[model samples]
Target: MDFEEKPFLRECKDIIEGSFGAYLNLSQQIGDLVNQHAQMVREAVSKLYSLLILTGNHSKPDTGIFMQLLKPLSESIMAIQEFREKNRASSWFNHLSAISESIGALGWVTVSPTPAPFVKEMTDAATFYTNKVLVAYKEKDKTHIDWAKAWLQFLNDLQKYIRVHHTTGLTWNSRGTPATASAGAPSAGGPPPPPPPPPADLFADPMKSGPGGDDTRSALLKELNRGTEITKGLKKITADQQTHKNPALRSSGPAPYKAPSSTSQPVVKSVAPPKPPRFELEGKKWMIEYQSGKRDLTVSDTDMSQSVNIYKCKDCLVVIKGKVNSITVDSCTKLSLVFDDIVSVVEFVNCQNIQAQSMGAVPTVNIEKTDVVEVYLNAKSLTAEIVTAKSSSVNVSVPSANGDFVEHPIPEQFKSIFNGSVFKTEPADKAA
Candidate 1:
């Protein structure tokens, strides 16, 4: 019998060849964009970051004041982006000296502390001023999450420093908390503040058990179990398994206890680390799966990659250095993706917290059933159509004048009204 190509294989081959032929120039442009910009801006950003830390970092243990000192840090990132634009050809990543300065400034601070009341105020202020601080890194646009984390870290450092090194006998309080009175202060003497309340027994019963049975019936153990005793149920099954075929590794002991009435007592499986990611080129599609914690996954070849399928990855940074037919990201979380462009469409489905950047032109981008996705479109991809449905916190950042990224949220809200006889729905006009 003569061999016949299956419809699926034939369709894949046609899409690959057709996309390559149609968008070859776009592929080269994206490849150039990646190679040119990815390694150029690091040196400048590092120098700027170090200078901000050295000049703005103060030893004072006041969070509000320290956050106020971030003004210079905010201005310097904008300058770095401008410098990157001008010196794109000459700059390279360098060993920055200012890292040592940052370490020494917060050396006394060790543990994280509860945020002061002004934390919410400062956070709101930071959100208001996000336009000034967000700078474009090679393919990754710095999101508010990155900026907020830095602010929260400095706040924590200041809190810890106050706790550790502040002199005794003087109370340092947050914005709204009451300060302790210094020694020998005259009291307002009103019935001695109604006498201090007595401390409760730590192991008291909720239902008022007798004193003899209190220890055994106390709710303390149950309360602790409800919160912190998560590991008790995560015990792995110890029976000999079909997957582990080696007899030497098999356990000689009896099988571990499993609870009966499984309808009520459901077993919680122990977590095992996922296998390292694999990229297989099947026909014309690149299948990327099980990826996690990977920082620099590069697909540099322009000709070989026709399309991509990224599935079930977490906390991964994948950069495709060339244009392709299409890319589909499915069932992934916390993915940082950077690609040049696509011939057809770049689609995201059932994703969460995904941040993607397109350095070159794209025809269309689709996001469906996603949560908290940030898309950065460069000067080239400004005209790309971003079609979104059933998604939220979807923000798109495009370049504006003055070398800053202006972020705008994709409108998920709509206004429906009865226009005479029929009801019509359109995207909400926030301006109206």
Candidate 2:
């Protein structure tokens, strides 16, 4: 009996192996089918986006709803495509594949429908699929969620792009009212102003030599100077975090209060610090020197109580007069200079190769005559961030580059990063 069963057992084994082989082949086919559907969906979305742009020239009856749905739909589609590219076999994932199929089916359903219905269906499917995918992503199997997010961003950008192009007419004022004059107001009937005559030559330069000989160069320089002054007011916020630690200007703490004989509610305790003077983060080269006569003057390395100056003579580099200050530089070619807190004046002459550092607390970056290429100029107390340039047509909008008045302090977040304890820590395992 045992000998007779051997052949049957071998036959059974062959049957099982053949079944698994067939199953593997079918699984692969299903995966390919899913990928094909995803690709088709992406194409459909791109076409829809284009159609929207073309049609959006005229105001839609329901423009707000259309844009709202369109934006999210494109975003979801982009997220889907991105996920597909990153995940080699996303289509084979049982749950994910089903969601992708449903989404793709929705595209087909909306193909010939009117904008209103199509938008409704797209919005529903996009939201549903996006949620499903997000859940999967949170579980650390981000295959579905990644695709959904990409698709969502795509849809959003498409809608936003269309909305921006089609929007027109005067914008509302701060009070949320139309900016045009009130319709009920009385009209001021007057003759229209005469139109100005065209010049003899349309292409002729306005600054061409006239009775007053060409003063174009001087006028242009003056205009350029005016623009520089305006930019000086735009300050770059620093990396310092502490903006409220000044003790000099802070108000005194509240005195202990005794409860009246009559029943009274207890006063709430305040957890925040007392009001202090707002101090901005100064850049490396310049620091806020003490408030002088009325205006703030920057203290320089050479002007310190102890002066240190570096000079180059006949090809020989020399520290001609003063002591060397701190030099700090980054790979980006940004450098900072730090000198004796007391120095009032420093000069660089006929020298190119230089290291940089940060001065202790001088407040403003004072730059003397030198052919420096690219430098970022920042004054801590003043509200301005500037890039200095030397070449022609290069715009350098620092404080003195085109002296403009600035009063606002740099933002605290940026200042904190630059002056924080964490930033000062030495590289170690702690960095890890």
Task: State which candidate has the highest TM-score.
Answer: 1
TM-score of each: 0.38, 0.20
Error in Å for residue 80 of model 2? 14
Candidate 1, residue 382: lDDT: 92
Error of 1 at 59 (Å): 85
Residue range with the least summed lDDT across 10 consecutive positions in model 1: 91-100
lDDT (10s digit) by residue, model 2, range 147-241: 55555544443333323332232111232222111111111221111122122321123444532333556677777889768577776755442
Show how many residue pairs clash in every candidate, following the order shown. Answer: 0, 62
Model 2 off-target regions past 4 Å? 1-34, 49-121, 166-432
Return the lDDT, model 2, position 1: 30
Q: How close is candidate 1 to the true structure, as a TM-score?
A: 0.38
